[model samples]
Target: MIEVRNLTKRYGPLTVVDDLSFTVQAGQVTGFLGPNGAGKTTTMRMIVGLAAPDRGSVTVSGRRYADIAVPLSEVGALLDAGAVHGGRTAYDHLWALAASNGLPRRRVGEVLARTGMASVAAKRAGGFSLGMRQRLGIAAALLGDPRVLIFDEPVNGLDPEGIRWVRELMRSLAAEGRAVLVSSHLMSEMAQTADHLVVIGRGRLIADTSMSEFMRSAGEGTVHVRAADPGALALRLSAAGAGVREGLESSLVVSGMTAGDVGRIAAYHGLALSELTPQRASLEDAFMELTAGSVDYQGVTS
Candidate 1:
């Protein structure tokens, strides 16, 4: 598990990360979400010791990343897939990382195969496409078979198939009992991949919650109701304290009432119904509403 407590970072007059606290638990995928320039990358860097925090602390499995005797064996991070030596082959990159961590040479080949890059092991990284580079970066991160993994925008340039592969890989890693934290701009993918979310805005923690809870609280769901006497049903529903609006030809969209309550009222009024469905808000909707004010750069039309 990863623990970030009151982690803060500043550069001159600009504070990138504020007093943020959250945890990435084992056996689940935690999504780190924010608008661009929301200090997400800085926080990840601080977790891996790439950038020292101005205050507070971060730890992996009860020890600071720097204090771990074999950091790679404990925590693996893929912050930048393009931050590799462009001149070297994919195999060489993973090999260098393995050697530096005192891992066996055979482990490099294993990771390459695991990431489906064994066939391109000898290919120069400079010639590889963005998707290929991402594979290589993941291969290097898995070289030590670490129990904790962190990925930043792992599907940035991936095609549809590649994106699906990454989604499955994250699930597989967490199934193997590894703690995984991922940051991505793809809300659709995040909805499918992450069990929990850590949302931040303006360098401060906005929400730390399960995906279900986030959606539930972020939206006031509407009930879709259809009845033989539509106008009558609407009047009855509104009288029951539900806000009703006309929907389609003969349906009513109701808010501030539960499906059960709607049904009970219809039965009480002897109103024959054809449909009664509850529509919950989507994850993307919830995320946008939650971070609406947090976006630093808003593009406006003249």
Candidate 2:
């Protein structure tokens, strides 16, 4: 597990991260979400000891990342996929990292195969495409077989298949009781991959909760109901304090009530219902709604 407590950072009088705190627990995928310039990269850099925090501390397991004897074996991070040396072959790069950390040379081959890069092990990283470079970076992160992983935009340049592979890989890592914290702007993918979320905006914590609860609390519940007598059902629903609006094909869109409540009320009034469906708010919807006020750059929408 990773614990960040009272984390803060500043540059030239501008506070980037403001007393942030959160935990990435074992056996789950925690998503790190934020708008542009929300200090996500800064916070992540602090966790891996790349940047010194002005206040607070970050611990992997029970010790600071810098204090760990074999840091790679305890914490693996892929902050920049393009940070590799272009002249080195994939195998050579992994070998160098393993050598520095006293890891076995055999581990390099294992991660190569794990990340589907075994075929390109002898190819220089400079010739690799963006997606291939991403794969190589992930391979390096897994080289030490670390118990905790932090990935910043792992799927940045991946194709659909590659994206799915990354999703499965993160889930599998968490399933092995390892703590995984992934930061990505792909809400659709995060919705399918992450079990929990840590959302930040303008360097402040916006939400730290289960994915289900975040979605549940971010937006009002909306239900679509169709009945034989649309007017009567709408009137009854309005009388019950539900905001009713006309929908397509003689249906009613209802707010301020759940699908169960709408169905129950319809049943209580002996109303014939043709269809009743509850619409779930998507992760994109929730993110936009929760971070509306925190966006640093807003484009004019005509």
Highest lDDT, which number? Answer: 2
Model 2 superposed RMSD (Cα): 3.2
Per-candidate local distance difference test: 0.93, 0.94
TM per candidate: 0.84, 0.86
Question: Per the 3 Å backbone cut-off, how many clashing residue pairs does candidate 2 have?
Answer: 0
| Candidate 1 lDDT score relative to the true structure | 0.93
The TM-score leader among the candidates is: 2
TM-score of 2: 0.86
Count of steric clashes across candidates, in order: 0, 0
Q: Per-residue CA lDDT of candidate 2, range 190-210, in tens?
A: 999999999999899999999
Model 2 stretches with alpha carbons more than 4 Å out: 224-254, 257-276
Look at candidate 1 and tell me the lDDT of residue 190: 96
